[model samples]
Target: MLAYFGPRGTFTEQAARGFATPQQELVPFDTVPAALTATRRGETEAACVPVENSVEGAVPATMDALTEGEPLVAVAEAVLPVRFSVLRRPGGGPVRTVASHPHALAQVRHWLAEHLPDAEVVATTSTSAAARAVLNGDFDAAVSAPVAVRHYPLEVMATDVADVRDAKTRFLLFRRPGPLPEPTGHDRTSVVCTAADRVGALADLLAELALRGINLTRIESRPTKDRLGEYRFYIDLDGHAAEPRVGDALAGLHRHCQHIRFLGSYPKAEPGGVPAGNDAFVSAAGWVADIREGRGA
Candidate 1:
């Protein structure tokens, strides 16, 4: 079974349906943590959830789950273009409140600011549940996917509700303790580490990878729990650990850094068929290339 973030009308559900094998059973959950926990508990062979968006930064809950001592491993990835619209009941009665999953609501806040200016933003457990709320007539409208509108038979009050066109979000496919199938060439390794608080400590660790000709892709600093001024840096690199340069860098990094965790090395997103004019896609590819080859001037 494959677990996904869903109640069916979510973008994650669409991602799982698009990338998964037809025979794979897609289990839906209210949160990425729940889906990831299900994978860790052996309830599902793999779990799919969004990690970041082109427009937004990282999904903190998803990152925490991956980094927080769980055996769940990121095994593959896919990107979906996010198109949001406002769904309402027929006859267009005045909307009282707007409902959606927190992330979905965040993604469309600018639209809400402009169009549904006075509508209250209330949190729902999932995007599909928001659609369900609107369907049940409690909410005047909801901000959700086109899939949700079709699934719940809601009317579209406005199309293209997100501020940016061709927005995209990244999804991770995870499983554990098995031989990963050979990649389709594009690949990435995600990791977490901490450096000594000394001034050059972070630079020294990064410099080692730079000298080894290994790319350092995405790096974000998340505060270490209960430790003031201490952080864990999450990094993504282009090549697999089997490569000499990458392996060497990890060895050197391990020596220089106080904490190092190799989350997983997995296949990267396949290039073709992704939507055009997406800033996030461009940003992700640049980061990937940097990690793969250290592409910096």
Candidate 2:
């Protein structure tokens, strides 16, 4: 079974369904952490949760859970093109109040401003929850995923209401940590780096990756929570950790940072892309393996 953040009609559920086989069951939890916790406790085979969005960046709650808890490994990822609909009850007088998950609201900020400038906006736990709120008469309308209309007694006043047409959210499939995935040539590795509070600390961390030609795909900072002014970086890089150059860059980063958490290395989202590292990286990896095995230097 796959556990997903949901009330049944959430984007997280959509992503989870894409990966599930016909016979596999999908269980919905109210929150992202709850779904992931199920995976950690072996209640589910995997958890599907949103990690980042193109417009909103990283999802803080998801990031915090991955950084703190009993170490879950991301096995795969799904990028979903998001399109939200403005939903209201049939014959609803007007949109006096708008409700939605904060991320969903943000994505349609401009649309809401231009269409219902004076409408009071409220946040909900999930987009589906927002629809439920509207159904319960807590609000007149909701900004929700297209699927939400089916689950709730809501009408689509407008479709594709996002300010940006190309907005996308990335969802990750997480499982218990195990052997690192084999290199796919086109892969991404995520890690968390906690650097000491000092001058050039952040720079030194980047320099280590730069020197080894590891291309960082994404980087975001989060509070370490131990104290104020102490932060850790969540970084995503182009190559798999199994690659020699990528492994070397991680080693260098480990020396410069206080703590390093290897999230996982998974296949990149793009299709038909060239594998990272090429022949040069492969040769170097082979040489290092040979030396470690005492076969040759």
Clashes of each: 1, 2
- The deviation in Å at residue 36 for candidate 2 is 2.3
Off by over 4 Å in 1: 54-58, 90-98, 101-125, 156-159, 226-230, 270-297
Top TM-score model: 2
Q: TM-score for every candidate vs. truth?
A: 0.76, 0.80
User: In candidate 1, what are the lDDT values of residues 1-297, reduced to their tens digit?
Assistant: 889877787777777877688898888887778988898899888888888762222378778888775666677888877777788988867887999878778878788898888898988876678889988987888888776875898888886677666778888888875765454445677777877566787788789777755667678877777566667788887766655556667888899877787777776775522112234435655788888896763
Give one digit per residue, the lDDT tens place, for model 2 in 127-155. 88888899899999988877777678788
Window of ten residues with lowest summed lDDT in model 1: 272-281
Native-referenced Cα lDDT, model 1: 0.75
Query: lDDT for every model?
Result: 0.75, 0.83
Candidate with maximal lDDT: 2
